[model samples]
Target: MKQQKGFTLIELAIVLAIIGIILGAILKGQELINNAKAKRLLNDVKGWATLEYTFYDRYGRFAGDGDGDGLIDAGAFATSQANFGANYIPPTSALLTPTTAYQNSDFDAPVATLEAAQLLPAAQNAPQRRTNVTNAFNGITYPASVYIDNVGTFNVIAVKNIPCFAAKVIDSNIDGSIGANVGYVREIDNTGALTGNNTWSCDANNNEQQLVSLVYFFDKRPN
Candidate 1:
């Protein structure tokens, strides 16, 4: 009988183990990248909030709602009046609209006012300001805005990101779980109350989940 040249089972097991190790490393690397992106999103939200507060402190009024009119003052800025208004009230439901073909309207008047007052950089004017920033994890353009709520009691700045992406943001900033009082809220419609639904809320097991696209309002708004 010819001598068998087949390798022993030990060799095969070693190769399989090496492959598993490589796969695990790759998965962990991807998870770290995602977490970094989520943190950046949270930072962006905080930055905008800080800018709003700075504007308020300098001018004694919200950026867009100049003159304390509870509406975006067009004359205060160099943008169109239509692009600046109390359209993003109730922050939970306000959808960011495109001001032109290339840019989404993001606090056009308020940001512009900040620019005009020299509180914000002149380059940070509307039509070119940070309207929609890309989410590194999901490749989605999260639209941001600064506006006063309907009651005129709060100055709200918000970003609309998909539920999963938003969840990452909330988890990093607030509680790690998507439970009630998570410092963020989700709503089905622009006019409805933000309730924890199955789609956006984690199940009783506390697993991260997703729902329809939802807006994530920052808690640092000035009231």
Candidate 2:
């Protein structure tokens, strides 16, 4: 209180304005970061899809389905050793095989197979394979798996832990809306039903803003 030199009304206003600007800048920067992360995630998915096609084109079979039986060839089903590396073993069962036809779970065998075939980078083992793979933007781990739907279509499923993050990916790549016409479908959780969650819908009513756990199925044909 030696000077009691409180800022005048004008000074206070200026200070407040400066603070607002700084906050705005910080927020904008965060937004740009988020956008970049979303873009990277989308690119990774696309890259995987492309690799699936390339693998099929070169090997005449999908990556995880070594036998081309339209089922995930893993565990005892795997007949051939993964050629991507020396110690990598190909998945002998479907990593994307849902426990109850709806709930999704983490699988790394497909990734290992891809690595083994030189389609994806090789890892030391299954756990290492999974730990090494992560989303570039958010550092979120990706659960990569392959499976054949009942319709006989080969699918590569990539799991994202965050629903909103997945939404950003779908919006950036396919369509911004999480509703119909979107390239990817939304599911509540790995085990949850595949559809019927209106709240998570990116429809006009929902705005596709809500966040939940999501699994993305990238389908491809085994030619």
Candidate 3:
């Protein structure tokens, strides 16, 4: 009877090496994608701040902050997971004829105000931004709701539903600290309340859990 030969030792070693190289490439590609996502989150925060300031400069008041109280009086984001639903676009009329103010203001007013004035590009609309990021576990997209509350002692533009891992990357880049509970950038509960300056989980392994909404405080003009 002829003996059957399995994979030769050298052939097996070469195959294993090729497999390792392929896996390394895949992981590296994923890392780059994650890094790009983190950059987008950071840029969105900065760009939103710039928009608020630019609106303040042009109109002498912040958009969505109709009361001149220097806070974004978001009617939509009055509570957790409030209006500005996944597809909520402020009226086309509002978009086309936006004033520095609105009759019934909400998160919509800010984007509407800026859009009408041509300060914000059409791409900056809520629906567009809402799709930019997502809840990692369930794949739900979180809109970048412009609002202010007791996210801290000051006002903030609530960047919602950032998974813990990305949040850590962003917080570290902005605040120079690695935790989620303090700094101009804070990790807030889904209820949109600040529980005070303390640490929260930055578990490297919690990559897909939409752990918190990050509120970055801004110097909205004082009343």
Candidate 4:
């Protein structure tokens, strides 16, 4: 009998099966990688915030001068830039012009306009001053509900990649207040006003703030 020159049907089928299995495993691994990346980004953001808080507690101000000046500016919370390892930058577009007075409306207007612009950028290479998503990860999308609490005029927000699920400005002392779950918030003015205390809590478990204040990045696996 002549030697077989081609793979048998059974062999071919087996090979295909093996290939399918390998592909499936690779896809699964990719998903895990994505999830891990998202988690890392989130953790990094948390750490950065913690660092800022620690630094402020020690130095009475945030690190990294937002302005070009070298000296650390006092009470300049909004302007200072915080690096979270990943290259996620905020928007540069001006909102109602810069003013000396602290205005919550300033943050609100830009967030609306900036988010609109970001979700729908004018160009592919457009310069971004603020980003709710991480550029390091693929398929990372920031939902509309991502925002900072604005109670007591706490406009300075600290969040990462999150969906449009709103945010909560919870005061530890507050009792059954309806304002804690107002969806994506832009600022949390002051924790003292709502709870008769000065402790602000941003909980991600709430339906209103489902994805807000979370630095998550995800990648979709092939089906």
RMSDs, each prediction?
9.0, 7.9, 5.0, 14.1
TM-score of each: 0.57, 0.67, 0.73, 0.36
Please identify which of the two predictions, 1 or 2, would achieve the higher TM-score against the true structure: 2
- Candidate ranking under TM-score, highest first, comes to 3, 2, 1, 4
| Model 2 lDDT, full chain set | 0.49
Comparing 2 and 3 by TM-score, which wins?
Answer: 3
| Residues 1-223 of candidate 1: C-alpha lDDT, one tens digit per residue | 9987986799999999999999999999977876776677666656656775675676565555534544334221122223443332222111112121112234445554555556545533323344333344332222233333462332334333344654556544554555433344333233223444534544444554343233345434322
User: Candidate 1: minimum summed lDDT over ten consecutive residues — where?
Assistant: 92-101
lDDT of 3 at 176: 94
Off by over 4 Å in 2: 1-3, 73-106, 125-128, 137-154, 163-166, 180-183, 198-211, 220-223
- Lowest summed lDDT across 10 adjacent residues in model 3 is found at 135-144
lDDT of 2 by residue, 1-223 (tens): 4867789999999999999999999999977877786676677766776776676676665555544554444322121112212344454333223221211222345566566567665566644554445565333333234333454433544434443655656544564464422346444344333444543554435543444444455553222
- How many residue pairs clash in all the candidates, one count each? 1, 10, 0, 30
Candidate 3 runs further than 4 Å off: 75-105, 123-153, 202-210, 220-223
Segments in model 1 whose C-alpha atoms lie over 4 Å from true places: 1-7, 70-107, 117-154, 162-172, 175-177, 180-223
Between candidates 1 and 3, the TM-score winner: 3
The model with the greatest lDDT is: 3
Q: What is candidate 4's lDDT per residue for 5-68, written digit by digit as tens?
A: 9988999999999999999999999767755654565454344445444534543433322231
* Superposition error at 161 for model 4 (Å): 5.5
